[model samples]
Target: MKGIQHQLDLAFGENAVTVSRKAIDAGEQNLVLTANTRGAALKVFDGGATETGASKLFGGNLTASVSASVSNTSKAGTDAIHNTLDTNTKLTDLTDVDGNKLGLTAGNVINISGTQNGNAFSASITVKDNSSVSDIMNAMRNLDAFKGATVALDASNGKFVVKGANGQDKDISNLNFNAQKSSTDTTAVASFNKMFGGFTETQKAQDASSDNSLSMQIGANQGQTLAVDINDMGTKALRIQDVDVSTAKGAQSAISVINNAIESVSAERSKLGAYQNRLEHTINNLGTSSENLTASESRIRDVDMAKEMMEFQKNNILSQAAQAMLAQANQQPQGVLQLLR
Candidate 1:
C-alpha cells in the first residue's frame, strides 16, 4: 500500500496534476481529512499568491528627492585679432620718389593670407592701373578665404579695418598681406612692401564664458525616495545625486544638471512606454496564437458527421456488390454439378 501510494503521488500529484491528496487507514491510525487539507496549502502558495503579494508591494507610488550643488564653470573663449590701417593711408600713395606708381601698376598682385581655426588660405587681387583703394578692398572682400572675416573702412577713424566675423573669436596673428609687382614693373616692389606696413592691431583676442546649474526630484517608491543630482549630462555617470544648489555657484551648476536630468527622465519614460507597448503586443500575439492552436486541435480531434456518413455509404455499396458476385460464383458451381449428372 505504501508503494502504491508513492506511485499514485508521483503520477497524480506532481506529474498529471498540480497537486493530489490521498487517504489511508492503518491500524490505530486514522489519516482522516489530513491529506486533503495538506495539498490545499501547497496549491494556494504555488498559485502565485506570494508573487501577487510582492507585485502589489511595488504597485504604490514611487518617491524621489533631488539635491544638487551644480556649478557651471564659465571659461571664456579668446577673441581673434582686429586691425586698422593708418588713417592717412591711400591707395594712390603707393608710389616711389620718381613720381610713378609703385606696385600700383596694372597686373600687380596683392596677396592676403590667413589661418582660421588651424585652416590656412591665401587670396590674390590683381591691381588695375588706376583702381582706387575702395576697389582694391572690394576685390579682397570677395575672396573665399576672406569671406569669414569682415573688411570695411572705419569711417570714424578714417582707417581701413579687418576683423574676425561676428561671434567668431579667431586668432589673426598669422594673417599677412603683401604685394608683388608684375615682373616688368620691378621698380614698384619696394613700394608695394611698404603699403601694408601701416596696419596696426587695435584689439587683442579675448575669451567669453557662461555658467549654469539646477535641482530637481523624481519618485522611486511609495513613501520612499531616491536622490538625483543634475550635472552636465555630457559628463560620465550622467547623474547629479549629491550636488548642493543653495549657493550662487551651486545654483549656476544646477542649471545644466537639471536640464540634463529632465532629458534623461523623459528618455527613460519613453523607453518604459515602448517596453509596455511591446509587452502588450506580445501578450496579444500569444493569445492569438493560443486561440489558433486550440482551433487546430479541435479540427484534428473533431469528427465531421457528413463526411463520415458518406464514407459509410460507400463501404456499404461495396459490400453489397461483393455479396452479389459471390452468389453468382456459387450458382456457376451448381450448374457444373447439373452437367455432370
Candidate 2:
C-alpha cells in the first residue's frame, strides 16, 4: 500500500507547529488599551523664558532734582529835584503904630514893605484888619506906602505874601512908612530880597518831605525783613520766587515711574500665559502618540483563540486516522501469522 503508517511517524513528527498551542496557552496581555502622555507642567517664569527669548525686564521710575531761586532788589534810582526849609528864619525888629518901638509877634500880621529907590513899596497880603497882615496888604497898593513895588500872595501859604517886580531885591534897611516910628525909613526896597531867602529855604525843605519816605522794611519770611530807602515811591517784593525740588519734581516723577513698572509687569504676565499654552499642546501631542503606539503593540502581540481552536480540531482528526492506519499495518503482520497457523 502506498500508505505507510510507521513511515508517516518517521517522516512527520508526533506534533508539528506546536508553537500555536504555546501561543494559545499564553493568554492575551491586552485586557485594556490604556494610553497616557505628559509634558512639563506650565511654569510662570523659569528656564522656559530664556528658551523662548523674551524681552529684557525693564525697570521703571526715575527722578532728578532742580534747585532754583531768584532775587530782585531796589537799586539806586534817579535823584529827583527837591526843595528845603529853614526853621530859624524871619524879619526881626519890625513894628505897627502905637508909638511902640518896631517889632513883630510870633504870627504878627504886620505889613510886608519893600523900599524901592528912596520910597517904600508894600507887598499885597491878607491878614486881620488890625493885624500886621492887613498893614502889609494895604501898603502894597498905595503909592505912598509902596512907592515902586507890586505884591503877590505866596500861593504856597496864606499867612503872609511877598514878591518883587523886575526880580529886584527890596531895600528894607532904610524902610520908610508913615505907620513905622518914622515914615522916612519905612519902605526900603533892596534889603527885602536878602531877608526873604532865609524863609524860602524852609519852604523848600518841607516840599522835599512830601516827595519821599527815607527808609522802609519789607517782609521776606515771618521774622525776616528787608530794609529799603525809598527815594522814589514804588512797590517791591522782599523775597523772590523759588522752586522746591523735593516736592515739585519728586511727586510727579513717582507717578510716572510707578506707571512704567506696572506696564512691565503686565507684559511679563502676558509672556507667561503664552508659555503655558505651549506646554499644554506638548502634553496633548505626547498623550496621543503614546496611545497610538500602545494600540499597535497590543495588536501585534495578542492571541487568536478561534484560529487556534480550528488547528486543534484538525490535529485531532489527523491523530485519530493515524492510529487506525497503524493498527491496519500491525494486522497485516497478524495475517502472516494466521497463515502459518
Candidate 3:
C-alpha cells in the first residue's frame, strides 16, 4: 500500500510539471503576439502597405491659397480741363477769351506739387516761345511728379484728363499745380492758373486683398492642427485666375503671379518638412521605449529553461527516493507479520 501511495504521488508531481510547461508555452505565445502588434504600429507610423490598407499615420495633405497682388486704381480728383487754344497754338500767341493781349511768354513755368508717402516733392516745367498745346502736354508728361501719372487728350471735348498711376493714390491726392510768371505778368500767371484750377481732392485709393488659407491636421490628438493663410500661392493672390495671358500685359502679370506662388509653396514646404522631422524623432523614441518594455516583460514572463530543467531533475530524484523508501517500509511490514506468526 505504501508503494502504491508513493507511485500515486509521483503521478501527481508529473502532472504539475506538465501544467507548468503548458503555462510557459502560453506566455511565450502571448509575447510573440505583443511583438507583432508593436511592429504593425511602427509600420503604420512609417507609412507602408498593410493587410487592411496603406498606412497614413503621418501622411499630411497640403493646400496652397493665394490672393492676387492688386494694383491700386484711382480717378482724378478734379474735373477735366478744356483747352481754349488750338493744338498748334504757340505759348507766346495765347490770350484770354476776351481778346486781351495776355502777356504769355517763354519764361512761364508750371509747377506740380504733391506728397508721396508723406514726403513733400515738387516738379516744374518751363514753357518755350514756340511751345504748342501738344508741346505743353508733352512737357507735363515729362515732369518727375507726373511721369507715372496718365495724361490723355480728349480732342472731341477739347479736355485734358489726368489719372493717377496704379500705385500713386497718395501722391495724386496731394497733387497741386501752380503757374509761376514774371511779377509784372499777372494775366499770364492767372491764365496758367485757370488751366489747372480744377485739382482739389484726390480720389480714394483701393487696396489689394486675398482670401486664401490652408487648414492642416498635424497630429492624432484632438485640436492638433495648424491653419495657415496660404494667401500668396493661389490663383487669386497670384493675379492669374482672372487674367488673360494671351495679351502682353496679361502675360507679364501672369509671370509675377507665378513667381509669388513659387515663393509661397517653398515656404509652406519648409514648414511641413520641419513637422516631418519632429514626427520621425517621435517614432524613434516610441520604438526605443517599446523595445525596452518588451525586454522587461520577457524577463518577467519567460521561463529559464536551464533552471527549470535543474528543478525538474531535483523533483524527479526526490520522487524516486520516496518510492524506494515506501518499498522498503512495505517489506518491513511483511517481516513484522512473520514475527506475529
Considering every candidate listed, which one attains the maximal lDDT? 3
TM-score of 1: 0.29
lDDT of 3 at 118: 66
Candidate lDDT (C-alpha), each: 0.45, 0.32, 0.48
The worst-scoring run of ten residues by lDDT in candidate 2 lies at: 56-65
Which lDDT value does model 3 have at 318? 100
Of 1 and 2, the candidate ahead on TM-score is 1
Error of 1 at 160 (Å): 2.1
For model 3, what is the error of residue 113's alpha carbon versus the real structure, in angstroms, after optimal superposition? Answer: 2.0
Write down the TM-score for model 3.
Answer: 0.31
Superposition TM-score, candidate 2 onto the true structure: 0.23
How would you encode candidate 3's per-residue C-alpha lDDT over 1-341 as one tens digit per residue?
23422332242221111111112343331111011101111111111211222111111111111111122111111112323545677766655422333345777876667665566666666778777667656765776656566665555544445665644544445666667684345343765565454455343332211222333445557665544443345664443354445666445534544555577678888977876776677678768888999998888656676678889999999999999999998999899999999
Runs with alpha carbons beyond 4 Å of true place in candidate 1? 1-103, 155-158, 183-188, 197-341
The better-scoring model by TM-score among 1 and 3 is: 3
